[model samples]
Target: MSCAIKTKNDHIHTPRDFRGGRHVFVNGNEIRYVIYADTKKGIVKYHPHPVRLKKGSDVVYTRTLKGLVTVEFIK
Candidate 1:
């Protein structure tokens, strides 16, 4: 499966956005799931939340001192 990492403020407007095993992380911690969904307030559904990487998964993330987030996958 393909993996992606984006900033916490990134908007996921549709369920299809999660198709490639995308996972959102803030300050180096993965977000498990959005606790609640409020359609009236413009919250998207979280039923198909992104899958979390396993402990030994070949995942790498880097952030600059200025807070730029970068994600990489190692073979």
Candidate 2:
């Protein structure tokens, strides 16, 4: 599958904004997922799965170290 991935130019200062929802590209298709932030632990969690693209109908992500990262999705 052919997927388009675009990352936001602006930086995400507040993790709360992710709570609203965000989109990501998975195998040339766009998929929406919810985000959760743990302020106390300084960790951000993406619901439904993490931000790794998989080659199937199911959306899955592998856990990784916490840090500043970019999320690219098809628009």
Candidate 3:
């Protein structure tokens, strides 16, 4: 899938624990971000250093990680 960031900046900053994934590119560089969600019981969950996602968009996290990290989503 392909996406774009609505920005004019030269550099984008993401969380430190992010991992690389299948990417959509703009001008040959990659876009990165993380996702956060809540379960049915109102339990908060986080995805650390997520990539290939768009801000303000909700996508099912398709990758796996070891250990615990607080993955937060930004719009």
lDDT by residue (1-75, candidate 3, tens digit) is 546544542132233424333232223333333232222222222343643465668764444322223222343
If candidate 1 were superposed on the true structure by all CA atoms, what would the RMSD be?
Answer: 14.3
Give the higher-lDDT candidate: 1 or 3.
1
Best by the TM-score measure? 2
Model 2, C-alpha of 17: deviation from truth (Å) = 13
Candidates 1 and 2: which is better by TM-score?
2
Model 1 TM: 0.25
TM-score of 3: 0.17
Model 2, stretches more than 4 Å misplaced? 1-34, 47-53, 60-75
Quote the positional error of residue 26 for candidate 2 in Å.
24
Tens-digit lDDT track for model 1 on 1-75? 545566554443233444334444334644334332222233322223344444787543222121222222223
lDDT of each: 0.35, 0.41, 0.33
lDDT of 1 at 1: 55
